[model samples]
Target: MFCTCLCLVLAVSGGVATTTAPSLADKHNALGFRVFAHLASADRNLVFSPHGLSAVLSMAQLGAAGTTDEAMKRVMGFSLRERGASRQHRRMRRQLRAEEALRTAGAVAVERTMSVEKAYRRALSRAFGSHPLQVDFGRPERAAEVLNAWVADHTAGAVPELLAPGSLSDETRLVLLDALHFRGLWKVPFDPRLTHRGLFRGANGSATPVAMMTLTGRFNYGEFSTAGGEDYDVVELPYRGDTLSMFLASPFEADTPLSALAADLSGRGTPEWTSRLGSVRRQLSVPRFAVDSELRLKTALTDAGLANIFNVATADFSRIAAHERLCVSDVLQTVKFEVDERGTEGAAATAAITYSRMAVEELTLDGPFLFFVQHKPTGAILFMGQFNHPT
Candidate 1:
């Protein structure tokens, strides 16, 4: 799991149609990828689900007010201010759940001592579909055990533990727990018989032998460039439901850093890139990988334009409860994923990823690259990552 954003901002409602998809999906995507670019560095295998993070944060945003509210609004670029916003969010949930292949669960755990407003509680249930939980933050370890138990139960033990030892403290007032599990089969499942050993070259020309899965089929594919003129290729591997798909991008030049491609993906170019992709036949090679990450996101979120939510002096959450002036203590996340010949199977991954493409053939991700698991119907990115040093 990989992501960080301080808080969410809810807008006062407008008349937008609830039948339409939430425009905020794009903003949610933006928040995720922006954080990815901020965290991208040498030799890290990052995995996160931005859609899940946004959903959890929206629960908290319903309780924000004043400067804290305004700050997040300016940063997230999406708001539930309009009367229709809530409807839109619900539509997204319904649209996402239309596929039984994917399962997601969320809950908001608030400090037991704080008296959260009933209105805020209702908003969480109505707008975000979250299960409300209250625990004793003063007893961080026991609180963690409760949260971990819920996560493990929902994720089938894939994430038996999320909160690290001492990651939570007495000062903590709120924690959001989200878990998503997806076992997607390729539209055309990869042939296990074709899986063979191949070398995945890494930074500085280091190569690790890996099991490479191969497929030659028609797919939505394209090639595009970054603002800095770094060229890259992309291919879409649709799941059985067609509502979700996996998109992969890699630099055409082996020497280029995955970060260059990551920057463009999290920016305005990403949506455009995906829109331009057309069906083409190609021979594709991708490594079998399993990645699980636990991250503390305060630094990454601050660097990614979410700096105000963690500042005690400036942070505001009065709309939530009145026990004390509550402020963010930490943003913790964990992500786990696996990919192989049976098709991609794993649970959890998120955000800004602007991308584009024409057509390409004979593509192989035998080196460092990027991957996104996207909800096609909503255009919301469920997972985002920079694949380097995968195991």
Candidate 2:
């Protein structure tokens, strides 16, 4: 009965098109590396893992679902390239499988680009499987209304509204929408009334008092003072199932050279740090911002490692397409993010991002802010961006 119920919801709400492929485990690893590198760059200074990659990828695919394999690789690959991973390393090379191998036999390509609502429904089906979730994709204007309503429902009003309408392209051939609502009793919940304005410095040496979320719990952490003359703290916050964890790192001092810090990174020391779980007070202050971005994913994918996929002369979507002549005309992406104590309630609605984080300076906003979004199934960055503005 549960399986039947789940499939019905998946079919109705999720726009997941049926394909011959079983599950995409190999692609997950390739995608993971992309996300990790992009967020960990010296300029952006963010950290992400495979789980963050999945969240963002699922959200993107939720809105824009045609030929996701290539776009997914580019987003993930760009992310990995940004962090300092070698572009031609053997490990990276292995992820580059022959394009012909990715196709399913006798697959007939469909030209109907899935709508964001359809893509989002597909994502929900993938995440919740058969669990019921509300999803809809129609006219561009209706997108905002449907998304906002979904957010309100899932977040339990934490995110009262999601889209402001026309947030998507009126002429957009497709749209993907993912509405995720999570309600968890914090291991140590913060007293809402106890919230106080605290100073958060930025790269420009300015300071603003922001509300900081507070909690305490036993967490897995890695504390280190790098030889390259930087000291930072890496804290891992585990979600309920233990299948996912959020890794947050902040420099010990505001002025610790970030570029050098990133240069000294070696995945080698990370495993050793896994044994350092302990209880401690956590002061978390995440800012709230909304951003929208539109991108030509087809080009971006070519720049990464999937050039063959777009090369009409060498393209191989044959598993889905009838002739080798057709190539991806356009790959569009749109995303939205909102963070608060209730544990991240927004989706990457469109293809862009508007992010605000604690400044690099402890007391002033004269340094940089860096972060990443990773996937747990395979560590990767679905999106990576940074801002140097003081405002």
Candidate 3:
């Protein structure tokens, strides 16, 4: 497969187009960082799919009105209230699915006895590409089994069970889920013969030996700094088909925290600097690693300015099931990711900008760093994470 892209964004404000406001893609990416910033604990290897999670939330927003809809619009940046917003979302989804190596899925499971509004179901099917699955949530185990099976099928078993035992109960009026799986061969694969053991510096400054992958090639490299003036470096590694790429970044100074860079990147979209990257040949040493994490995002979302949906009284699902009482119980996202000599395989999270290094740049990630998996065509951050502790 051959992949190629560098997407751009047209900013908008209120109901008018503006050059100063954050674009739709930028807002979503920013939300990813805001959520990750909240979920981030002390030096934990965390990964979650911001793209997937947003899809589920957007689905929920379709059924909202009044204050509920307004909040979702403000927090997420785009809404059904905006002209052509749904069409834009659908177009973005189609562009992402065009690449065969990436798999994505979304679903809304409703209680077997309650009826879902046709308009809301149609909205999910049209905009998010998800169909409502009617299941008996009263039997929690059976409901979980059914939902998990569908998720496993979509993820190719990488995530067999997204919801563990007792995650659901008889009161589960609705369930929203998203599954993303991607396996991409590197455009320039790292040779295992050159791979060797090296010491990795943990977040706490402790060192441990890990398998390190080394590659010296010309890549889209850039040196940048946070608003607070902390320096960092970024390297772009494309998958076989240029459709997707992994952009890895880390602070240049050992004392500088990774969180600073993450926060800056969240404020800037990929296009802001991707076009400015200079092709440079650098000797790169990065740890081959994998991480699996389950993120409880209810508190994070509540903190991010969209809390009404989680509260039954304040929430509005009138567009979904007008006669029934429906409010979100919780939001959960599970992720599994891996990197090796051949390529990148992962599912799911975000968390900066520019300056440069002259001469032969030998960049090595021996400490905590952050990475982003981007859909180059749309400039959307599909997955992101902060690797404080190697797994």
- What are the Cα lDDT values of the candidates? 0.69, 0.35, 0.71
Query: What is the lDDT for 323 in model 3?
Result: 69
Q: On residues 1-391, what C-alpha lDDT tens digit does candidate 1 reach at each position?
A: 2222212211111111124443668889988777777677767787776776676556656666888787777766666644778888878877766777766666777776666677777777776686557788778789778876776777766666666576566766666555566667778888989889999988557789999999998988877798999888888998887888889998878888988888877665456778878888888889998777666666787776666666656666667774456555446566767887766756542211100023446677888888998888888898887788746
lDDT of each residue in 123-196, candidate 2, tens digit only: 34444232222233335456546545554554345444434454443323322233332222223434566555
Residue 100 of model 1, lDDT score = 73
Q: Best TM-score goes to which candidate?
A: 3
Badly placed stretches (over 4 Å) of model 3 are 1-23, 347-359
lDDT of 1: 0.69
Q: List the residue pairs that clash in candidate 3.
A: 3-241, 3-242, 3-243, 48-349, 49-348, 262-351, 264-352, 265-352, 349-383, 349-384
State the displacement of the C-alpha of residue 242, model 2, in Å, after optimal TM-score superposition: 5.3
Native-structure RMSD, model 3? 8.0
- Candidate 2 — what's its lDDT? 0.35
For each predicted model, how many residue pairs clash, with residues at least 3 apart or on different chains?
31, 60, 10
TM-score of every prediction relative to native:
0.87, 0.50, 0.89
Residue 176 in candidate 3, Cα distance off native in Å: 2.9
